[model samples]
Target chain A: MDVFFQQLVNGLTVGSLYALIALGYTMVYGILKIINFAHGDILMIGTFIGLVLVMNFHLAFVPALLLAMFITALMGILVERLAYRPVRAADKLIALLSALGVSIFLVNFAQLVWGTETHPFPVNISGEPIILGEVHIGTLQIWALGVSLLLMVGLHFFVNHTKMGVAMRATSFNVDYARLMGINVDNIISITFAIGSALAAAAGILIGVYYDAVYPVMGYSAGLKAFTAAVLGGIGSIPGAMLGGLLLGVLENEGAAYLSSGYKDAIAFALLIIILLIKPTGLMGRREQQKV
Target chain B: MLELKNVMVNYGVIPALKSISFKVEEGEIVTLIGANGAGKSTILKAICGLIKLKGGAITYQGDTISGMGAHLIIRRGISQVPEGRGIFANLTVEENLGLGAYVRKDKAEINRNLKVVYDRFPRLFERRKQVGGTLSGGEQQMLAIGRALMAAPKLLLLDEPSMGLAPLVVKEIFKIIKEINQTGTTILLVEQNARMALSVANRGYVMETGQIISHGTARELRDNEDVKKAYLGH
Candidate 1:
């Protein structure tokens, strides 16, 4: 029972990071109707950026995190303008291929600059783990969950109450109709990329803190796991991404702890396959409904 | 209030509007009656800047609005209710109406306009909380019109408002359109239902194959043998 509780706590910490990253995938997918394949690579770049900020610039962890997210957001907008927008009117395959090209380019660019070395994440909360009965919770774990929950809540309010957020929702419904309503559709699309990219950066930094290291290629594995979570929750649904991430984290942690440490990733994949076969639209996803 | 001089629109070298010239005078309901693909809807799209003009110019209130972006054109006081009643199906009726007043800065005037829209279409007010897609077809049309009215447009471009409704519902919608015109907005109506279109229009133009082949007062066009046979179904 103690082992189970510890694993649950560990699972939730990892799950919070996944939820943050998965939001980027789901939001971009929601607006553009294409999986931004470069998203993971972009998160990888964000981790490196945060690391450089702390090491070279000697900035505090909190300010470095904000600066890193802001810079990553600008990078995201640039990527959209240079790579994605030109291929927008083309076939979906063309956009997908372009995204793949961007992912490859970003990975290579990181390798050239960061030199493929895994660096220790130097920042840590100045406290020992909090013990509750038999289970212990790391301060980092608590921070991860608290920040992720706060960001998600902030996102929900922005989407529901703000004028720009309403415009974004309207654009997601119908682009041409949104234009008729005087919405700058291009501007809305750019804002979606900016917000998604910023969230992914925060996730990147959080993951670096949790695992105690950052590397150029870390985005590949983390991004894949987060993408699977988004698909599991229903790719284009915002709340779906959060739910999917949490469930995947818990399941993977439990499977690894009880089943086999070597097959932790394998277990997540197996569950994904089973879920996909049972419900293609995902756990909370409905098929796109268009009324005539 | 609106004038087009030899306006030409092309979709990648295939001409959609061929140097079409027309004038919409202030305070009159003008109907452009044509079959599908005759470019009646295309004209509305062009006027609202949804589609770019390949040649000529569109002027509204003496300022040339040609080459402006679609979003910018709405600020010029022209709003279009597109074909197929382009309602944001996922949003509530109130949200839909709120979006129509998107660019306006005056809060008090926006609230007043909201009241006017709700008063004009009481059914919309009753269903304000419902998602637009769940509404019946007639209700959806009313929502679309109500939304456009929230913009407080000086010129309302209505594209096929009578499409796909029961004749009785179409009559109700047309009566509402006439009432809206009487309350002060100039209308440029495009319709395939020429019988209904002609009944409410002060002046009418008959279009064929992207060209205006005939134009006259509604009574003159209604009595003409060609228009009756081609459009009125007499």
Candidate 2:
């Protein structure tokens, strides 16, 4: 029972990070209907930005997190303007290829700048593990889960209650209709990228703190996991992404604890295949009807 | 008032609109009647800047708006209820109406417009919280028109509001169109149902292929022999 509880806590902590990163994927997909393959690299870039702020500038945790989020948000917008926007009206394959190009460029660029070394993430927050009964939980895990929950709640309000949120929903429904309703789609797309990237930045920083390490290639695996989470929950559904992330985290952690650690990734991938085979549109995805 | 002087459009070298010229005078229901693929919809797309005009100027109240973006055109008070009643399927009927006033900033005026829309179509008011996709076909049309009206547009462009609807529903929609026009908004209506369109329009343009082949008062076109045989099924 204690082992189960411990694994559950660990799973939730990891799940929270995956959910945050998956939001960027789901949001960009929601608005543009593209996978945004470079999203993981954006997370890596954000981690580096956080590292620079904390390690070099010696900024506090909250300030470093904010600056990293701000910079990465701008980077997302810049990526949209320069890379994604040009191929927006093109075929899906072409846009996807463009995204791949960006991912490659970002990875190589980060490798060149950071020298391919895994650097220790400076712990501005206290490195103390909180013990509850027989289960042990890290403070960073609590912070990560708490912060992510706050962001998710805030995102829910922004997407449901606010004017821009409604516009985003409208745009995703029918872009041309949205335009007819006087919506500036470009501006909305920019905002989606900004918000998605900001969430990713927060996730990146949280992951750095939790793991106590940051590296150029770290985005590849983390991004792949988050992408899977988005697909599991439903690619264009925000709540779906959150659910998928949490579920993926719990399942993977349990698998690792009970089964061989080497098969952890395989177990997750197998679950994805099973879910997709049973429900191709993901858990909460709306099944598309063929409109004549 | 809106004027299109020698507008042209092409979809990658295949001409959609070829030097089409027309004017929509203020407070008049101007119907553009044509068969499918005759470019009536293209003319509306050109007017609203959804498609780039190859060579022409679209002026609204003496301002050149030919190359402006679609959102800017909507901001200039020209809202289009696009073909097939392009309601946001995921959104509620009330939310769709709110989106129609997307460019406007006045909260009180928006509420007033919402009330006006609700009053005009009580059915929509009843289904206000219902998802737009769940509505019946006729109800969807009403929601679409109501959504467009939320913009308080000076000129409303309705493209085939009667398409795919039952005859009874079509009549209701046409009645609503006339009522909306009577409330002082100018209209540019595109329809394949020439009989119904001419009956309501003040003036009409007959479009064939990609150009306006004839233009006259609605009565003149309705009585014309060629129009009677080709469009009226006489």
Candidate 3:
């Protein structure tokens, strides 16, 4: 029973990271309807930036995390302007390919600068575990879960109550109508990319702190897992991404604990496939009605 | 006032509108009535800068706005309630209405407009917190018009505002359009429902196969033999 509880805690912590990254995927998809393939590599770049902030600048954990997020957000805006904007009117497939190209370029660029070495992020958080009855939880894990929950709440309010957030939602529903309403769709899209990338960066930083390791390829698995979460919840739904992340994390953790550790990734993929087959619009997504 | 002089538009290789010309005097409700393929919506799109004009000029308030982008055109005091009642499905009714005045920065004026919109459509006021997608077809059309009004536009362009609406609801919508016009916003209405459109408009244009076949006073168009046999179901 204790083992199960411990694994559940671990799953929740990892799930928070997945949820953060998945938010970026879901948000960009919501507004643009194009999958930003480079999103994963953006997470990877975030991790490296966090590493640089800590190792070279000798910054404390929280400050380093903020700097990393800021940098990643700016990088996201640059990517939108340079890569996404030019191909805005192109075919979806072309945009997809362009995102993939940007992803590959970022990965290689990180390799060149960081030298492909697996660098360790300094452990600033105390390694002590707090005992809660029979279950022991790492303090860092608790921090990760708390921050993730806070970020999600912040995002929810931001989208619901704010002026720019309303515009973003409007643009997503119909670009032509949004433009007619005098919403600067280009600026709104750029803001979406910025916010999404910043969330991914936060996830990358938390994951690095928990794992104590960062690499150029760190974004690959994390990205794939978050994408799975986004699909599981509902691609364009904000709350759906959070729910999907936690569910994927718990499912994979329990599967590894009881079934096979080596097949944990396989479990996530299987769940995705099954969900797609059963409900193509996802658990929370509604099927759009077409007008003739 | 708005004028489209020999305006041409094409969709890839096919021509959607061929050298169309018309004028809407300030403070008048002018309508363009036609069948489904008569390029009624295309004219609205061209006016709003959604599609590029191949040739000719669109002059609005003495400025040639033919090549301006949609956002810039809206800033110039024109708003469109497009076909299909294209309200933001995920946003709440209030948020959707708030976005209508996105280009405007005056908070007091915005709030004033909001109160006016709510007073005009008490249904929207009752469902201010509801998501736009869940609204009934009539409510959605009302919300679309209310949103356009939020922009404080000098000119309002409505495309098929009566589509997918019950006749009773259609009557209510036309009533609102007339009220909006009386309050001093010039209107360009495009509709397949010729009778309702002509009833509200001061002048009307008859379009067929992307060309304007006739234009006159709304009463004259309504009484014309060809219009009576084809559109009015006489």
Candidate 4:
């Protein structure tokens, strides 16, 4: 097996997961023009919810994942309602601060309830690795890549084709005009949070399934990496987030295989800095057009 | 159909609209003509529920709509073609029109209204698939008016539709506005171009320094020396 190809596959599997979380960041940022700092903690909460559903209740993986995603979506809405909504009209900085508060509250709350100990993830499916001429691919890799792609495609169709999705885009374009068009902007915002959180939840559970370990602090590091991916793709663009995540994942894995495993996290941020330095708007971010 | 009774609005400490009162009886084109900073746009915003009135009441068909949410106000058959055209630059022309009918759930009715809008502006029909931003200024203004029309509003509020448009295009837009009024949709038009506005309007109000300085028929405003000097630019 080619070492480079093998590492690339490994990187893509992880990157797809990152893309999922990055989507949440990009989406909320698109609507509110603020980074949802609490999105990371939402990932942690989703993992724990998944863990309890599968481990304690003995439910199947798919059901648990869906349930966790639904619950995490509600948690997302709750965070927006409690922390972000009241401060929405005050100052942009206040909303950012409230997001940080929500992030901290979720992390400590998770520690208080689920504790700091890591729980081994309960996905017990097994399959032989798919071998090509030079690379070995596992079922988890396929699952991670396939599920994320499916969700992303579904999201794309929903945002582009559906009425509510069009309303979301309209609201993001101009809040006042959206209100003039009879769009309830507050509901649109809540729906944005809900969708973003659900995607993050799915990513969180996938990370746990891939690593076979679920822990409270996983979100902190993973979220930072995903956030880097979001910025890499240009913050508010959806496809940019996905592309950024995949690219970051591949780069991180290649760097780990060639340079050192200890440099994996550093590689992600390093790539982010390099990308931002070159393109400032991330990969897919639109350059502001000044019409004469 | 719509009336603003002593409506006052402020942008922080600076008063934008000063206890201004105006009326638009059903099926009439009532133009509010003023220079920039004369609160012409502010009155439109207040009527559409985009801004809270600092004081006074706005009644639509005899019900006080002053404190209603902007989103809810549209559902009651009031829609606005705001200043700047307010097109969703990223959305296609068809999508922009679809959003105009958002408050209504009846799909068949929406498509019928879509046909009416398209027929009224064949230029929009030709470019329906293109994103709204790429359209010429006049086309965007048409899309803005077309979008408001899709709401099937009883009272339509137009804010500076002629801003940034060619003279020929302005003539065409005002023609459509006249036709829309003939079809029984009441119009409250705010315009900086006083000559064109008063020419098309049945009744006209001249505003200055956040107050209506003169009010009369189009011919009355046309004959008034002060109106011609300040706004008609003769």
Identify the candidate with maximal DockQ. 4
Per-candidate Cα lDDT values, in order, are: 0.90, 0.91, 0.90, 0.91
DockQ of 4: 0.73
Q: What DockQ would you assign to candidate 1? A: 0.70
Summarize candidate 3's per-residue lDDT along A130-230 as a digit string, tens digits. 89888878888988998889889999899878888888878877788898988888899989999999999989989988888888888889999999999
Q: Where is model 2 more than 4 Å wrong at Cα?
A: A126-130, A290-292
lDDT of 1 at B123: 90
Where is model 4 chain B poorest over a 10-residue stretch in terms of lDDT? B225-234
Q: By DockQ thresholds, what CAPRI class is model 2?
A: medium
Q: Pairs clashing in candidate 1?
A: none
lDDT of 2 by residue, B29-90 (tens): 99999899999998888888888888988999999998999999899999898888889888
Cα distance off (Å), candidate 4, residue A119: 1.6
**Could you give candidate 4's per-residue lDDT for residues B1-234 as a string of tens digits?**
888999999999999988899889998999999889999999999998899899999999989999998998999999999889899998999999999999999989999999999998999999999999899898899999999999999999999999988899999999999999999899999999888898899999989989988899999999999988887677
Per-residue lDDT of candidate 3, residues B173-205 (tens digit)? 999999999999999999999999999999999
List candidate 4 stretches off by more than 4 Å: A126-128, A288-292
